[model samples]
Target: MTVHEVHFPVRFEASVEDQPGPLWKARFDRYWPAYRTWFLRTATVGRPTYLDCRRAMRQHMPELVPVWESLVDLAGGGDVEARFLSLWCPPPYIGGCTQAVWLDPTGHEEPALLRNYDYAPALLEGNWVATRWLGPRVVAMSDCLWGALDGINEAGLACSLSFGGRAVSGQGFGVPLVLRYVLEMATTTREAVRMLERLPVSTTYSITMLDRQADWATVFVAPDRKAEVVRQAVVTNHQRDIEWPEHAKATRSVERQSWLAARVAQPGSAQDIAMALMSPPMVQDAYQRGYGTLYTASYRPRSGAIGLLWPGSEPWMQSVADFKEGQRDIVFPPPPAAVGST
Candidate 1:
């Protein structure tokens, strides 16, 4: 049997609060340094101006404009900080993920979303957040400050994302903030799909959405192509087909997609699905290559509960209604060099 080459240790924390106040400001203070680094990584190539960001937000995501302004003030109102909060037309980044909508054959277990978020630990924000920013409560894994990686809203809408395998870039909002907007506004899987259609996303990505009404769909969106909402139970890194062979190969997208398709077709407990995500194909161990399975997330929309799972540990459970602020110290097995490339 083969495993990893080294250990990547990280801290995972959770925060539940209503509307930005003290906690939100404190979060900005803590993560601003790292967020600034990520926002400026490609600064040599001329980025957008603060006015450009605000104008784009007001034009496309008008409802979030107020929230954006408030967050900017909370972040100390620096020009760079305001621009990054807008998340408009940011540089493209890569990540690998395997996500599926799992349903019980006998209609016993909760209709759920299972996913493995694969990315470099150093780049991971690693915070589980529950907040009531707009109206309904939203519980999500935070990415770029206020952006959501995967989340469930109080209205019984849950969704997760996988980086669509492509190297395209364009004039649009970063996918993370787009996802945050969806969770904040949309209430069902269908509505989430509609929201994706009108939004100008900066890059390619696959979004799997599930609602408590037993409705689900995987919407494939990209800056360079038309967005398609497919009746897919599973999605891994690509769209209808692998347009980027190198990325698809490195992430084992095809293999993971096939494995998950079969895995979800069978009847199993929620634990079974989560375990599958934590296993091979669905899981990646290529930390040295800037990709790895950081966590396996199980979101039950009906209950608004999220099971954050990691190997060698019990799941840390959270919900939109019953969120308990906590933290986990995780030490992942050291990864091999370019584990995804093998």
Candidate 2:
């Protein structure tokens, strides 16, 4: 038996709000049905208890508790809604992404964080969001309804997450919420690294942080080990070694990492580095496998600007400093079968 080939159209939206309100409500209403179905996929495994979820929030990320309550309120405040929003040891998820820090030797381009989010398009939240949920403004792509996939904060810190290419799962929060927490709480790469060192992720993930000070670090966090922080720039699906060979092969993680590493070692502008992500070896077009390059996100942490690019489409630009609200209908024309995947 085999799976049928399929592809999807993604609707990328830029939404702004000071707090949870109409935009959040409409989004919840539009996607909660699908989200509910996905959330209950682990019914047989027994999802975490609501009390346990709240306790985890209180114990680890207490600052986000109020925001959780607000999101739950907007979600109708059911037991499942509360638990799912906590992102505390919920259902397992894995995604493909390529991220790197751009430091130009020519002194022409400001430091930037370049990312390509490769995933099943239908599952992509598609919300390029800007919010003031926790005081400082955050501009990011939304995941888990409210959590960030990759984003920059008003404090000039930018963060992105990629699956650590391991199957291990344990008691900890999802990486999406942790990314959100970092954007809200940290002001620099050093501060973000320290925070990730102590935060427990439910599974393995590689988190890359960049700041306006031209500082950068990549933290490899997992459920089964202590966090490892390195000053390396490029990150893909794995950590120091390839732990999952099948996933490594499927995502072409090693090849993509090597390609980007070689690319980063050269002299070029930040835009040149970001544009590389759209080409072969960096772009993954295996939509049939549930992971394909959906969008390229270039974050200029020095100025808090986001450039959302497609292969042939005009880049949709936004910023944490002054976010514009609009929507873009996105079409993911398949890229050529490349030498590697992101």
Candidate 3:
């Protein structure tokens, strides 16, 4: 899909939080700055529940109160509006796997990074901690979707988010914080899935988690406080293995997923199949979407490695980064013993 040109100035810091379990929630509390209102409005469908997520964030991260207050003030009377509203509604049939390829139409350009800094070297004084500057290297959109978007934590657990087609009309789910929370709190995929399943959030979304040993599951949450887990396997953009009114809706993204899945080689790593989904623009839905979409991401739990490919670009941009594509890969490592086990 041709995405709205967005320049994301992001930073990834990997460290244990001050408190043991609050890592995910707290990070959402702390670094809620870079989150753009446009992403929240359009992407999240502008639910008041999202605001509740922000409120929880403020409660947990009192230190960022000033900043949060400023953001709220910027919004004036109510929730901040999103500048960009991109595609959502890829078919639910586009199943996910322990090791699968990822795709991000956005975050594919040269990073117009204003500035970046990390505090991992200085032992974390609190629950928040970050890794060293892993890369000063230039990367493509993988950073938004591959790097910071989803990846494994130092403890070897991997996490990723896929769309969930459910109606969400509340004010309390913070998407970025939720992503960050998984990496921060859970050391294994199972733990991460549990955290998401139990979280009393009102956001309409789903998450896939894999542990160091390849155990994987999906956590789906709705505005009704109804959360369920698809044990052993999961997928998204719609409910997996079940039909929901929202999931059944036909959209171009759904068509593309079906088209890609048919051509993908099965009984192989999902990551490989995902990469296959990024077929050349000639065969892709790029023409359907004037903006064009070609980037995809895949994760190999066995190797604790991630493979990224950009078929739309010249020479086919490919590299391996940590689960989080926020940083560039200097050297791709060997795959791990199991698919999802870090």
Candidate 4:
């Protein structure tokens, strides 16, 4: 097992308003079918959100209709697909996501989502453009994953989704695909929570989200539709403070959490917090190797200041994104590239 950590320095012009949500829909139009099929075979969920999302795609993006339908035959679960479609709709209430909006501790929620991309293609095709073959305009950018590990978004909405080490395998469930959905479809913590509730998820795992604004929270969903939250503020690997079933025999999430807590407190400066979050240690567990233990981020909304600390690799990675005037710079070697058009 290998763990890789990457830092992103996002630059946003004051002229740019809120990031577009339809951009995500466009991405779904191209990639949703493969993902949906994967989910039907692998994930578990309580509501029909996943099915609804697929329908939305079929109507809005006709090109993907066949691909989506073909997945049913490929997975040989057309009945499941039909069942999901029958119950899908907009949810009434979404849960709370753990998010910390650092308004400069003064007032500045203007910082945009800093883009960071990391992944293991063998586990998940790293070159996002590969998704484009599914259709024209299909691009997977600014995402992170180790095989099927976890990632953060351009909006600083980061998540560490893990397969519960416990070996309680259920029906066909696709986790990676659903994770992609969370990042692509949801913009806020509440929306992310709804995405989890409405969709079907395979396997028992935990998903954590942290927007650039600093708000952060974790949700643990089981294959049985029963969901719990790790409401103590932040989440690491294993889980704590929440009463949820463990997916495996041995989980280090608690140890990782303690390791991080000892390093940084809640009410600290962005720099100190980033440093504490950047520190890394070793873990013999296969699931965590190369995975950065401490992932620190600070957002000064007043000045649109965003910082990231990823010390998992030999040369610790650090960077800053100043959204005030649309400027992003990296302090580490092998600087990050400028945002490009797909």
Clashes of 2: 0
Measured by TM-score, how close is model 2 to the native structure?
A: 0.95
Give candidate 1 misplaced runs (Cα > 4 Å).
1-3, 44-46, 334-342
| lDDT digits (tens) for residues 1-342 of candidate 1 | 334647778899998877888878887898899878878998835788988888899888898888899999888899999989999988788899888888888988888888999998888878888888887899889988899899899998998999999898998899999999999999998888889999999999999999989799999889977889899888998888788999999889999899889988887877888888876667788876877889889889888878898876767987778889999988765333322321
TM-score of every model? Answer: 0.94, 0.95, 0.50, 0.46
Model 2 clashing residue pairs (backbone): none
Candidate 2 lDDT trough over 10 residues, lowest sum: 333-342
Against the true structure, what is every candidate's RMSD? 3.5, 2.8, 13.1, 11.1
Per-residue CA lDDT of model 2 for 199-222, tens digit only, reads 989999999989999999999999
Provide the global lDDT of candidate 1 against the true structure.
Answer: 0.86
Q: Write the per-residue lDDT of candidate 3 for residues 1-342, one digit (tens) a residue.
A: 222222112222333222223443344344334334324534545333434544555554334344334434434324432111111111111212111232222523211100001111111111113322121221212121112335455555556555455545343334434555556556676677666765544346566665556566667765466678775232435655334453334323344445444443234344334444443311222122222222234444444444434333221222223323133221111122211222
Question: Positional deviation of 8 in candidate 1, in angstroms?
Answer: 1.4
Q: Native-vs-model 3 lDDT? A: 0.37
Per-residue lDDT of candidate 4, residues 1-342 (tens digit)? 223233323221111112223333343344447545544663456545555556654543344345445444434446555333222221111111112222234332242222111212212222222122132211222221101234344444545465343333343234544555565555566677777765555465667665655565568765665667565443443443433334211334455456545543454444443444332321221223222122233433223334433343332222223222222233221222311100
Error of 4 at 324 (Å): 19
Instruction: Rank the models by TM-score, top first.
Output: 2, 1, 3, 4
